[model samples]
Target: MLEKVIRSPLILIVSLFLMTIMLWSVYYGAFSNVFESVLLFVLIIALSTFLFLILFHNKRNPERKISWKSWTPYELKEEDEGQQWVTYRATRKVYIFFYFAIPAGLMVVAVFRHIEFMPLVVLFVLGTTQYGIYWHESRKYLNDREEV
Candidate 1:
């Protein structure tokens, strides 16, 4: 169970969401002083650094670093070249929404709610990084497919 969770990037996703919400709360006088904000910031940085090291660390064999079991939303089973190409294309399009639209929507909601800006900025970074990861994975998958 622990290994499965580690293999999934969902931890990173949840971590970002929680950290942002906490930041929003702390920054807007939810904690009564700057100490609380500083504490939250330290914790967020620590967690993010740990997760990033686990997610993107490269040892001797870089290809062995990432686990495919929980990285993608797709099934990614055996398929013909055409089918695989279609899957890759679909993944690309989906990430386009994830990259820009999601962050923009979040910011719009935040603005309406009068939330702090730092959280939204982190969210935008998360969105952009998620897209970059998805793009790199798609490219690698497509290239591996062609080689096969």
Candidate 2:
């Protein structure tokens, strides 16, 4: 999981760097603008395709190699119930922490760099939405548990 997180951000960083270069090249008219735009678009698409293939190929396997043994429905239901509440609570906490931390970090960086407010507002909204979704889901899970 740590490797997965690190790897994805590295890809994003590299992509951003490439995009910056492409933009600078276009601004300087070092290359034909049309050709540069097409090349950048193709690069982005190819990178996304490659990443998706690497990430999801395992889950997209056609072979059903693993078989499940029979179990009582009630037993399986109870097993799922045992972990649901704790899992939801943990997930909620994680989302809440990230929702605050990411924007706060971004704001600090933006202040240091004298960046504009529009990007910070966008980040704030995105983080708030994430927090809201996690909170709502966590509450629903808790309510469901109570009803049981």
Best by lDDT: 1
Q: Taking the tens digit of each residue's C-alpha lDDT, what string does model 2 give over 5-76? A: 323434444555565556556665657878798879877796776556544543554351111234221111
Give all candidate RMSDs, comma-separated. 8.7, 11.8
lDDT of 1 by residue, 32-86 (tens): 5676667677776867775665555544347645454355543253258765775
Candidate 1 Cα errors over 4 Å, as ranges: 1-3, 33-87, 98-148
Candidate 2 clashing pairs, residues 3+ apart or interchain: none
lDDT of 1: 0.60
TM-scores for all candidates? 0.41, 0.30
Model 2 worst lDDT window (10 residues):
66-75
